[model samples]
Target chain A: MSGFDVGGRLKQLRMQRDLSQRELAKRAGVTNSTISLIEQNSVSPSVSSLKKILDALPVTISEFFAGEEVSREQVFYRASELTEIGDGVLSWRLIGARRPNRRMSILHERYPPGADTGEDMLEHDGEEGGVIISGTIELTVNGEVQLLTAGDAYYFDSRLPHRFRNVSDSECIIVSANNPPSFSDGGDAQHHA
Target chain B: MSGFDVGGRLKQLRMQRDLSQRELAKRAGVTNSTISLIEQNSVSPSVSSLKKILDALPVTISEFFAGEEVSREQVFYRASELTEIGDGVLSWRLIGARRPNRRMSILHERYPPGADTGEDMLEHDGEEGGVIISGTIELTVNGEVQLLTAGDAYYFDSRLPHRFRNVSDSECIIVSANNPPSFSDGGDAQHHA
Candidate 1:
């Protein structure tokens, strides 16, 4: 879904919690206009801003996304149905698009040779685990680097700074699942070059 | 994994947290013997007892199970490779068995007609979500009941009292994922008839 839709979901959650826009904005340390703008789809809230708003609601990011667009009934998404969430050399296929009430996001991710996850490391709440399905990838969690090949898996708290890159000459594929969902753009990974 | 295996995992977690057995018992409100017996595989803990012990550790059941047998490097489990954790009419196939350090438990669950989750409701920690892959099932959360058919999905906090049954005549299949992991035998679903 687009950022515009995220606004409506935020509004729904705010109302469900019986908090007015002004009250929520105050609790979230954001301005009432910011909340209003987000709800009206006039502006897209940044990931940090959205995190603050969700924290004030006492809801996880995954729950917030799960509460959006409850009308969908499609299940068992085929490979073609996976939503493409990444840009650059990283290709991320997110299972179940517009799935309501999602607690975890299952991703089929692919990284081509020489792919790097930019310079800025990723830090988020919740937990993440993945299994390398093919080829090899270099996973760095809080500066602890591990070169994981096919069949190698990892589980870690997402709050730790982490990055992934394809160190091998061949392509790498991984199936990963994470909770609380990530609010950043799928391709937040910057190219090392 | 069996109850004996759970004991080893519990011990590992306790050590990892650097908590003495006596201290853990005190925190869980159970006797030291209970903790000792559980850790030694001399006694199998009930679901409730296990919850208390896990809560004392501040770890979810999912995390506990995920911690067990961390040495394996197998990934991409085939249908036959799925671990069978269920008994009776409710069959559950767990993905990525023996894969180290998992954060989530994904289950391919099937329930034959007339199968019910017993008289006692199931309550645990974490969050759960599932999609009805085929047939129909009745899901009760708290006290609200919903009959979900193919393509329908549900997500809720696992602490809430909930139960499931195959209310339809045909068999039902669901692809479910839960966090903090469930510790009971997959088929703890008691049949009413």
Candidate 2:
């Protein structure tokens, strides 16, 4: 999905140039039926055949093959398909779990009532941020407690001890992301309280 | 906003350990009035004062001030507040524009009918990925054409010549992210045509 179907692309370019199959054949000095076979993908053209074909269209080989060998990386995810991370009282559904070499981790997080991370002693020392989409959460970072509701957000360096608690009865949802992906290997200095 | 309110945290910590003001002052060999003054933020506690106070609670100075100097970065964004980027036929709403040292850029893109980037020859050689949210887009990358509709997605190296055309009459919307942010500086190789 990243690059073109060579035969189909050739046909499209020829059409854009207003050249008929026979006209292109004559222009490329190839057999008239050669165009037919190539456009239909019935035959894979050789390199020289590609060169001659592209040359007749006045297109560069590099331009034609710029990303031909590259395959499409999956880029879409359904809510049901998001990979669930961590089995704590909260839920963290990670976006693009299959993406190769992602520089960040975006998650749809849900904090239910009675969810108190402070008691568990989970301190992830990475930069973390998020937008609270619904409900309220009491976020404590380095012992500073702030009650943030919907539309409120705070970002901070994570070297400090941090924890979250949903004092409300409703579930709190937040779209959060972390740099360097802190949840994958448990944590740097992991200890359960 | 990143660190604790010294007065509040002290009070909370004291309460957590079941120590009254007189009890803590007796434990730290300090005057009981000093605890009350500090707890009320009536005076900023000196370093030695903090050490004595923390000692009474059996908490380390490092643990208390781990990220105290670090200021909280803006962590939450409202949908109505996303910065608008680009003045093309498409609308790109950038998320977290105020975030310092951002590693990635997330955008909500909308392509109106007649919007086309091919005729403009706008090619950026960066990795780009997006999910189509609504309508449809005729995406041609290195001569490969794919019509992506809602729920479909694609990720590709932008080294290939790529152009987007909203072939459908309705507007198309997509949620996309890019690394290193390509739209700035009018692209790597700037040519109008």
Candidate 3:
């Protein structure tokens, strides 16, 4: 919520996408000066204004706050360090932020009581798989949707669009992995473990 | 080194490759009964014999011992749980194991002085990148070899038949991840992490 923190994250996100100030300003319908000022920490963006810019960038709000609460073991990441993304119903935590020289990015996702990714199926260009640690999640790939409970696993080609939802009232936790490890928020990743 | 552990891992690796006892035995230049006995814990093969079988499978010894340690956290994996892979020279450990439902796998790898993955290069079907944590490693992709030191990173397609080696006597450590998380040692799931 601090302008400095927001600006820092904003700058990181923008740099990651290889965006220039003028280009981002044009896309977000803001003045170049405004974008520059916000990035320089000279001005704080209102929640709505920030949301607008993020929407234009198409970055999820939850992803904006995903890198906090580092672990103490200096080896293992603490749960508190996990940044929660998405709504309270369906959220994801990026694990091991303090880890330097990381090769793959890891995420811990939680599906709320009766929450789901979406009704539409999704597909992408990566290898996806994971183990269900708890609760229940209904996943549909292609024309078939399978109800996976604890201990079950699914590995699939990510190019196919899929949908996921929590069938149980309690929260569902799933451990998932995608190959090629794109660690940003975009439509390229599928939500199933 | 125990007979029980080796027998179990052999069976798991076989299943991962979808090979039956008879098929594996034939390819391994051993009798079917011998393979069956080894898997059932009836007999332990000598080191040479086991190595022969492993070579036929084209897997490394490091993969077999990768998951030997157990984690102390409820769902969190301890850094101690990681196992060193590749002779005494090059080693790797898993970090994305805490919650298996995420889309990426994280690994910590180390290389010894003058240790190399050998001259043969490897190219995979997934995208890969990692930061160098310590020491230095000479990474060769296709015909290009880049000497990378701490904090440097490179991402490339796995199909390049790349090889990495450490030219120094001091050990080098790197955190790397591959799409789909292929077990270079095979699928022992050693629980080392």
Candidate 4:
């Protein structure tokens, strides 16, 4: 679960749905070799390719990552149990790891001073909302810049080109949530395609 | 913020957007009287009507209920601070009330033994997903019946006719979340129209 076992997970899901590799490839509008390479972990499928495959299975991106066997009794998640993703100056603490069937991805995120999402900006499907927990961050959504301080919240469709940066000389904290969880590392704009 | 001050909240949002009641009514495709009655707190708007109004404002139902003045610094909510909305054998503990511009409504719900949502099934716009925390419950979604137990989860489009009942002798607990929060009390199916 630490590293994204996309191949293993995809194979599992495909089998679970009783879909053959050729069948899945046809359904996903991809070549058989593409599915084969993905299943064999020989190639990293682009975000678009992965999305097409998942859509063919009729499973969401969040469900694809939740894995096949999810515990039924596990409810509350402790702060320590949060799955930490992202690196460098940005940190994302994701709630409810190993919990199945998540519709939303709730993240307690932090960006160190001067940290930025990069020059490329970010784009994805679904909607994103967050409350600025502490410090200040400059948010640019589709060329509109807004300086959001602690207590200020923002909601926007993720399809817009958006980027976040800690404009202040202090670490910024944000309680962000996204519907139909965008499973991309924020650095790559291509991940959104 | 404790009670659903939908009327006051709608008026505030309408004014904030610099839209008159007539303008909002026109955009929402409802009669001006409908908007007036909703804002005056004289009539409870149906889900469809409320959705139309919110869509005209281009805000999600979750954002509408997050209220006008949401503080950015208010990130964490203690268990005691959860807003209790449902009555009778059903109780819903809603999280992140003071945080503004919410896109999702996360709830910790409880249903006592023999409790049911009612004879009439519920339907609404948006998607819902929940994990059964404890005990057993029977879920009927669009004529399909599912007996879900602890750790089991359900996710479906809220527009599907759905109902839930605690079939076991013990109390049932569910941690549920919905995109674009359904503000209506579940007992009234008329609210859906």
Give the TM-score, chain B only, in order for the candidates. 0.58, 0.56, 0.52, 0.58
DockQ of each: 0.03, 0.08, 0.02, 0.03
In model 3, which runs have C-alpha deviations exceeding 4 angstroms? A1-75, A96-103, A185-193, B1-193
Clashes of each: 5, 0, 41, 4
Model 4: which docking level applies?
incorrect
| Model 4, TM vs. native | 0.38
| Residue A168, model 3: Cα distance from true site in angstroms | 1.6
lDDT winner between 1 and 2, please give it.
1
DockQ of 3: 0.02
Q: Residues A44-155, candidate 3, lDDT per residue (tens digit)?
A: 6643455557767777443464333321222223345454555656776654433432234445567887887676666544445544557888877666668877645555
Predicted structure with the largest DockQ when compared to the true one: 2
Candidate 2 fraction of reference contacts recovered: 0.19
**Per-residue alpha-carbon lDDT of model 2 for A1-193, expressed as tens digits?**
1123667878888999999989888888787788888887766664356557777998744345433334455544555666776567877776665654443466667799877775644554345566566799988777667888875555566555778889999999766655434444233313211
In the range B24-59, model 1's lDDT, one tens digit per residue, is 999988888988988877766754567578778665
* Candidate lDDT (C-alpha), each: 0.65, 0.63, 0.57, 0.66
C-alpha lDDT (0 to 100) for residue A115 of candidate 3: 82
lDDT of 4 at A70: 28
Ranking by DockQ: 2, 1, 4, 3
Encode model 2's per-residue lDDT on B1-193: one tens digit a residue.
1124667767866886789999999988788898898777676664456657777775544334322344456544556676776577777766666654444456667789977875644565345556565799888776777888865566556555678889999999766655434444233513211
